[model samples]
Target chain A: MAKKETPEVNAGSTADIAFLLLIFFLVSTTMSTDTGLSRMLPPIVPQTDDAPPVKERNVFTVLLNYKNQLLVEGEWCEVSDLREKAKEFIENPLDKPNLPEKSDVEVEFFGTYPVSKGVISLQNDRGSQYQAYLQVQNELQAAYNELRNDLAKRKFNKEFKECSDAEQDAIKKIYPQRISEAEPKNIKK
Target chain B: MAKFRKGNKGGQQKINTSSLPDIVFMLLFFFMVSTSMKEVTLLVKIKSPEATELTKLEKKSLVSYIYIGEPLSSKKYGKEPRIQLNDAFATVDDIESYIMAERESMKEADRPKMTVSIKADADTQMGTITDVKQALRKAQALKISYSARKANK
Candidate 1:
């Protein structure tokens, strides 16, 4: 008899094993990417009596009541109209006396350009729904994003995302997103 | 009849499936590479709200998630909304300590770039959310993200 050799393992079941692992990976894997609205919370400030108060015209106040009602700058407005309203408030295209004031700032890419001194203050009632608050926040953010896009398009002839880092910095400096989420107070009435 | 008989005699040859394992292995390798195992087991029922303007969170290691929603077991936990950190249910007070611990555990250089993501349910009241935010502020986790899904057009 010839020398004994090890029996060949069946290859038929190998495909089945790989299929099992593939299925496991397919089920266990979470392919969904994480996305969200990026916001920065103001650092905790010490209680002070002599803090410089912001001017009324310089602050664009957006209030959301518990009923999901929009109270924008002391006027009742709808959510859909917030973007354009906010854009107008930021740009102050006509430089209305009631709107935010602009000061000339020497930017890197662009020479001396006027920058708005506006701070968007968003405050909501404790009883308000999260969905409504987020909607308001989204509208405000959209307003700023639209302005940045338009400026980038005009200055560099490119979209905001396509602009160089320095160009973007200049644009950002010109239209800084300074949304402040204030502490919730008793606004139930 | 003769031609038919001849054709029947020379039936189609069976395909060689010897490389079937190779194909399966290739797919298996692909899935293994692309797979991102879920980081935490969610104890709360969270349905994040939708928003149009979104920034994709980058650098997985730098993100610390804070989940806010009603507990999955509403019977045992009552109907009140809860904050979840990692695997356990936590309170608003626990958030500051949780954030501090998370920051301490990270690399020294990465601590500043760390982002805290608040994944709050759409239906939850703003009261609880406010409390969480206040706690985060005290903890000095200023860079916060409100986790939201992309709004469908």
Candidate 2:
């Protein structure tokens, strides 16, 4: 009997098909990883005076005016000076009488340590630029980060991020991020 | 020259491109692994501020975005700053409902871990951001991030 044979399908166009799909993904998707400053907003509470007020000395007032200038602790200051001033207030290395007070606290995986009671109270005007606000926030954050890194290196012999979870918790307990962003008041521009 | 020319017998042979499909497939697999599918169509012009201390926003599926800036089409939306949620222009009051919708769409177990990322233009006024913050507080989306680019020192 005579035999009939079927020809193979052409695989030459497979490259074109793959190229089309690759181009589609390249055009539709972005190559950026979302990065940012993460924060937790204070929960809404009913109007009440029950909460205890922070001490006058413990509060580090940061004012961002309409002109996007900074006034730290009732003094005209530049953004460069803010980080050092914040670190000083938070660390109180010299135990300055005017700086924020520190209290002893028992931390996990670490012995008794004095934790600062400083709270950075940030207030911005209605017309202040968001970029300026973020800069100020970044500076303040850098201060805490530097302080944490110093403590980690001195005690744990490692950078802040490289420490173990418990060691990190101990460091965080010693130097917590205490920035408080107050609501903007209506200022006539 | 005559001696070298004698080595060539005829026209040059064609290149074997049987491996072309394999090379293309490699490229296709790379993009598929490295790039994520974009979920939102932004309507506002957002150029996020730059900062040194940055935290990478993980779990793209669990994060919803809020864009605040001047509208892309200023003639229609006016020059005033606007907020965009998903693919539409949204008002400050609409933020609550939008958060609720996003929360409802997610699985029950993953709702608590949801983080709202605010991508705002650097030049925008603080008033617009303050309004958004209040709305977020009311919506109970307490965990939020201000989207920014990594700035080198």
Candidate 3:
């Protein structure tokens, strides 16, 4: 009897097989470059009977109603102007008497309590749109960033990102972000 | 001159494709290494809002996502926006346990670095988001990120 011969397997189609698998993965997978607004939530504190009330003048009230309208200090304000408005409120460039203040700590650039006691009180209605809320928050943050950038440019002759850690910390101390978000209020239809 | 003369052959020469598989395999391996598999199939529709100030989340291992939006199949799961933890639709109450479980699963050293990312639709209301925020604060997950796209210039 003749010895049985094993058939030679064809390997010519290996590349084609790999190409098919590669195409499948390429179509199914998405390369998402995730970007976001980083924020740290205030630690939950137990309600105490003796908590002192924040001064009305120290707080820059920003209210968002159900219709996506903005009310800055009880006056209707446009979203486009929010950044400038917030900057004025925080920096109090003219040393306005009504603006927030802490103990005088003279700094190299801006004077003491530039924004230490200035709190942006943000309150939104339950029916307020998320987009509007986020935009408001963005503008508030932009105000702080712009203030810091300006200070960095003045003191170090460089942009905020180029400043050293200590320099950045100094700038931050002069204009720290003090956004306080209040609980959403119920809106009656 | 010698190198130029070497390419002067008139006869038809078929290009070699024997190494094509090697090049393709290299690309396949590259994609496999760089690409992370989609861990959860999205049931809700999320069109994140656009913003100017955006920061990129650096480490994949240290981040967990919390999705909030209306269900794609609105007929089945009402028109209201809902919170989704992983693949399942969840409520604000589920956040505490979910965060605790996620923290427990991580290495002791990495627990402090964990960040919770909220991917909510632009049209979603503030009420739901506020609830999520409160839950996160209560859970001691202080570091939070609101996922958003970069606005076009």
Candidate 4:
């Protein structure tokens, strides 16, 4: 018999292996979640012996329950109520009789005074729902915007929207204690 | 004799790679057995902020993961921001001390600068998030980042 040459075999098996490995990783890898906001926060100022304590009552308390329910001033209120409440209280500064009779409170000359009514503390109960939490935030922001607009209109005695940026900023900070409180929180027990 | 010599020359030509399948399969098999993929550690949950641009970080730095959420308390203490950094739980105080200590131990050559990759829960309080940011600044580590999933449209 005539000698026969060795036959070649299919080598596509390697390509198949690569394809499988690629597919495996693509399916097996776990995706990461998004971490919110990159804020350039201010330094924490160490308290000095002369430094006055932050006013406790000046804080506005908004509490959230585990059910995501909201309570403003210990009253169960809808998420939409926050903005209106903020606007009503912030703009019409209460006659804070307990506050120092000084014309203005300076940062350098810190003093203890009854917390201004404009300070709002928004608290969420631990059980409060997520959607409710977001709803409350949106309303609070809206309230601040409304307060700003109202202040600008009073300053210009005209349509608030037409007010200059500088004029708006000036009026917004005109009442420094207005809306000076921090954001709402979910306080754990 | 001339025709026979011509046939001999034609038979001497070399074969191309296309004609070889067995050798290619053997190489593929070798690589499959030897190649190993790197394993990545499981990071905490976070809802990254929206950004128009994304950039990768340097490999040499020490990464600290801080989680934003309640400290598993049940009594309801009114509204105060709560946070947990690594194993210790506190309001955001230990953040500065921890980063400072980590910085001190780093080797001169391997000392990577500090940057925090916050992995926060989607339902975490904004106050807690902001508090953590403020703490990082107090720690004097401004090179902070939020871990995010690559967007797939």
lDDT of each: 0.93, 0.92, 0.88, 0.53
Query: Where is model 4 more than 4 Å wrong at Cα?
Result: A1-59, A93-117, A124-134, A157-165, A175-189, B1-121, B125-134, B137-153
Q: What does candidate 4's lDDT look like per residue over A64-116, in tens digits?
A: 66766777766787765777776555554565543222244322212332223
Kindly give the stretch of ten consecutive residues in candidate 4 chain A with the minimal lDDT sum. A106-115
Clashing pairs in 1: none
For every candidate, the chain B TM-score is 0.84, 0.83, 0.91, 0.53
Candidate that would win on TM-score: 1
Local lDDT at A85 for model 3:
88
DockQ of each model against the real complex? 0.72, 0.64, 0.67, 0.11
lDDT (tens digit, per residue) of candidate 3 on A36-92: 888888898988999898887789999999999999998999999999989888878
The residue-by-residue lDDT of candidate 2 on B1-153, one tens digit each, is 777776547979778888999999999999999898887777888888999999999988789899999999899989888999888888999999999999999999999999999999999999999999999999999999999998867
lDDT of 2 by residue, A1-189 (tens): 498788888889999999999999999889888999998998898887787877899999999998999989999999999999999999999888888999999998667888999999999997999999999999999999999999999998999999999899889999999999887786665
True contacts kept of 3: 0.75
TM-score of 2: 0.91
lDDT of 4 by residue, B5-92 (tens): 6545647676564534455455545555444333333223335433222335444236566665443442553333355554545566
Which digits, one per residue and each the tens of the lDDT, describe model 3 over residues B1-153? 767767648878878787877888888887887888899999899999999988899888889899999999999999999999988999999999999999998999999999999999999999899999999999999899999999998
Which ten-residue region of model 2 chain B has the weakest summed lDDT?
B1-10
Angstrom error of the Cα, residue B18, model 1: value is 3.6
